[model samples]
Target chain A: MEDSLVLVDIGNTNIHIWEEGKIYDIKNPIAFGEDVFYISVNENKEKEFLKLNPSALNLKNVVNFDTSYIGLGIDRIMACKAVDDGLVVDAGSAVTIDIMQNKVHLGGVIMPGISSIKKAYATISPKLDIEFGELNLKKLPQNTQEAVTFGGIGAVVLMINSLKKDKKVYLTGGDGKFLSRYIDGVYVKDLVFRGMLKTIKEDLREGKK
Target chain B: MEDSLVLVDIGNTNIHIWEEGKIYDIKNPIAFGEDVFYISVNENKEKEFLKLNPSALNLKNVVNFDTSYIGLGIDRIMACKAVDDGLVVDAGSAVTIDIMQNKVHLGGVIMPGISSIKKAYATISPKLDIEFGELNLKKLPQNTQEAVTFGGIGAVVLMINSLKKDKKVYLTGGDGKFLSRYIDGVYVKDLVFRGMLKTIKEDLREGKK
Candidate 1:
């Protein structure tokens, strides 16, 4: 029964669905049965999905975690919930770095993702409209491409390193694998799904669902 | 005679003119007499200014610097020229951090300016359309505003601090004063102009101009 269960995450840009060890990213909500559970940061997409299947459970209703961050996105909360300790980095449209210690959400910072940083550079000037290349943070950049790339990727890498002191790091989101090359971290693509599943299991054990 | 000379910097967004002890920011190029030396990153604006005063000295022709970095901006070069030993940070449309020691240019990195970072956040998601507030780098941000602010400002600060070691930092550009409050540096508004003047003085002494 657990293998058949569908988990959905509605984000700003896409709707991600996971089922039976397979993941799918869709622009629109798919037809799911009553056994589906979902989390959404996009309100309009949530409403659209709910219209298709009103019985689908919203994970936000079932999951609970200790966090002091007010107005934090549910997506971020779910990512943090999966980690009992260490740093959680979700690098997609926006990069969120959350710290979890002893099952408690310490706090996190948000940065523009790789593509967003690229777009920001292009917006600043036509000369900066180039793709970011490999950067060695040990040495300063000597050329424009390296300079911009260092600024975009190096900033994130340096910030994570600054905060990571002796803690394991979990990487997720679209750019996670790419960032993993620069940062010493484990790439967990299904981290959010893991958090949702863990929450459901806890909820079931307590006879709450 | 030095007091009557005008120094203009044509940037992507505005034309900055430094005359005597006063600086002026204008959208359009102003009519200046022959006693004008200017550096420009905007080709269109440079053409417009040259149309009015053909004999006006282009600082790029007179200024010389020792550097291996190719395709480096003239404005950045000018900023670096003013300093013999230190980090030169020109935080305008783009935050350029260049390292110089013993009158030799080492290298640098470029990060988006504060406003560009804000725009990048907004472009990622409308929910992130908020002003960056003062950040405490010691602690992880808890809220969205703080998170975004910390990411924007904290990243630059951390990068600068990491590279600083024992080097003195010089801050210039539009947001130089604001950044000075965070980074231990002196804000010099006329840094680029000073570089240009120094170059012209050297050229005159060598009978090259």
Candidate 2:
């Protein structure tokens, strides 16, 4: 068994795993030698990963960061490391834009996520009552549902445009993939996990520094 | 039906009513009379009121002010007329403090409302989940729930203290009643509706200036 390293990418909706440079779904725990990369929101799943092998405990490397911090989101940090200098957009539970220049983060904006946008519209204006997914790019939505989707996506896209300045753009998160196709930018599905791994490795090395 | 008048008071949470010189629940239609006073959001509820008396639909007066071009909630206009040179604290879903000196609003703050305060804690620190009612005046709460409530109220109280300057304070809204007791001010629940009625009467008599 090699030195077990657990890489956990805790997100609003899901936790991702990257062990030996491979993504593993924690729902089904597997024996990945001494190096076990794991991430989860559900306590039972995390415990399951830990119990994959009793001997795997001693060499376990765990990294945890709370997502509630104002300037820090796991995904944001991950995007920073993934791109040297670019606009990183995470359209997850909320739409956030993190700007980085020369590997240094330049603060970002926190707007209503895709769902929250629809939720707010429906909530604030009862006349606009509709669901979130109903939003899609239409020249002009004939119905309220289509109109709402267009409205919500339009607002977010406009916001993203406001944040974008001559730089490579990267999109991540569940909503990110869906929004990426419509956006003029690069898309990285595993950006958060990859960023976490990079940050962990940096912290570990900086400990020596 | 002696020249029936509709009064509308739109606040953060629910719109209020002042019909025929009496306060009524904005949701209830019976509280209305002839001559429509469609003011702010309550215009949505007025349709129900119209059903009761067919004669009430004689004049539909929609109070339309450019909210975008001008930074004012309809409640502020009412507050301005109801109380001369007073500090109006509309504490509903969110706490807003507007000061009017000589019948003119001097701008205000859009700090997190009590609910938003509770929400911010949950959003920024979801682990400390708690409700507003549970909050107490404590320096340090022994538990997470108390801590959340304490922090939320403390923040509002602190903000009010900073913004307050010896001026007549008037509190409105349902939640405003709860907060009024804690703050150094007077409570005028019917101010919004009363103000709207006053505005309509003035506009009707004077003709839109």
Candidate 3:
């Protein structure tokens, strides 16, 4: 596993690393390791990665789903490709849901991830002094503190319930557990990485021919 | 009716006018007329309205809901106050739902409205060219065109459905017509105005005392 290629999914929020099938969060101290399969929407970070690991395969250029829309986002496409069918819900800085059936990636929705929503209101209205706390969507929110938490998380829970209607929905991301709690979904970590590994295996098979 | 006060609800997307019990959309040329009651979250716009008519009352500063949390938008509280026991879904640049029962304001959820989602993606990825045409929530979106359009509207539809479980929901705002098609809600054209009128009437009653 030490010598294995690191699958990196550079997202709007964080740099997600998949090492030996496990997901690791890496930020600030960017690591340039051995063989790397990299994909990112942020151009500046991608350039920095390229400079550090010249041999790193820019997976963004390599993987394109037949069903993915133009500018659908490389990170999202990779997550969609990981699954054979049904919905792939990636909960990064923003949550993206792409429906893939029989390898064809159908389109999905994008909404602000939980923390992003919280960060938004707090940033705009600093006078409120909304600090972090637990939330219960079942009970009526009493004050501004409860309202912000519920507003951010409740909207997303409702979104997941809407799309996951009577279908097997897969959840992956930092806040996947938080979202999955409200809805019935299978949480699979390192989905983008898993998709990258599949891509590498396919490329190797094609190269041998 | 000529001497009736003009109600202006300056929102994130549009400036809504309620005059003679009708709603008017004013886009380009800003209108100024006799006796205006204005409510807006935007401070600059509030200042401009104040300059236009020094006598105009900005309800954002004056009206405070007994049940609403601090920093809750006046537009939303006003909308909630319009309904006695139901859900108020104000569909503007952002969709906010406030729960009101027995004149007690329960908390609500806020998310990006239909057009905001569309504009956001188009702004981030200009090359996509997501010009609106038609949307079918039942059908799987074929390409980026369908994805962006459907994604924007569909998510909000689902959100409405989630919040509307067993409870009556009312739809308002610029995109209310678009959202109404997918959900079961009574479309109230000028909710902010309706609420504003209610607020002004209450104030006048209190002032008489």
Tens digits of per-residue lDDT for model 2, A1-209: 22356555544445566665676544455545655443344455556656764454211133332222243544465666667688888776656676677776655555446655445454444545556444343343334454345445654565565457688788987688878766789788778767656555665435532
Q: What is the lDDT of residue A81 in candidate 2?
A: 65
lDDT tens readout by residue for model 3, B1-209: 44577888775445677777777866422546767778777666666667767777776555546674545778888898788788888876567777878777877766655554555555444534467547677776656666655555666666566666677888887777777877787898877777777777776436532
Q: How does model 1 fare in lDDT?
A: 0.90
lDDT of 2 by residue, B1-209 (tens): 43466655443345566567777554355544446554444554545545664454221253422212133555555555576676777776545566567665555543334554454445543553446545444332334454335445644554455446678678876667887767788888777766666555565556773
TM-score per model (chain B): 0.95, 0.73, 0.80
Worst 10-residue lDDT window, candidate 1 chain B? B200-209
Best candidate according to TM-score:
1
* Interface RMSD (Å), every candidate: 0.8, 12.3, 4.0
DockQ of 1: 0.86
Model 2: clashing residue pairs?
Answer: A94-A113, A135-A149, B94-B113, B95-B113
Fnat by candidate, in order: 0.85, 0.00, 0.33
In model 1, the runs with Cα more than 4 Å from the true position are: A207-209
lDDT per model, in order? 0.90, 0.55, 0.69
Model 2 lDDT, full chain set: 0.55
